[model samples]
Target: MVVIAKQNVVDILLMEAFYEMHQVRDRLNFFQEKYQQTFENFSVFMKKENENFEYFDDYMEWKAYTKLFDEVLKKIEELKNGNFQIALTALR
Candidate 1:
């Protein structure tokens, strides 16, 4: 049996959150490079042009990544600010 302190748990959560954020950012960067523009700009361009199936598919994926990136950033911020009780509670 092993005992883990609360601060240790928080530190682990912060590390995991940072890792997730990095992954999400990488995905966002891939989309940005593929489109040669930010998601918002690509979205606007898509709206102004005839809908191409490939672009549409990429758009959906890019949108999802964009949202996930934001969510991950928020999680990292919360963990950094010591608002990780919810995470610890859920682990119980």
Candidate 2:
């Protein structure tokens, strides 16, 4: 049998949360790059078609993803500050 203390459990959970946040950070960077590349390609296509690329400035897909990415970043910060307990409670 294995034994673990309450503090140890909290520490372990914190470590896992930190790892998850790191992964989220990586995903955020990846998506940002992907979106930039796609947008650039789209702009090139619009220019070829003689369309105004400025209309994409208010693109809904881009806006929604940007908001979601920001939220993920904020969640990472909250997890870093040890608010996982509160978060877990909220989940329950």
TM per candidate comes to 0.83, 0.39
Best by TM-score: 1
Worst 10 residues of 2 by lDDT: 83-92
Q: For residues 55-84, what per-residue lDDT tens digits would candidate 1 score against the true structure?
A: 998898989988888888888788778776
CA-lDDT, candidates in order: 0.84, 0.56
Clashing pairs in 2: none
Cα deviation in Å at residue 16, candidate 2? 0.6
lDDT of 2: 0.56
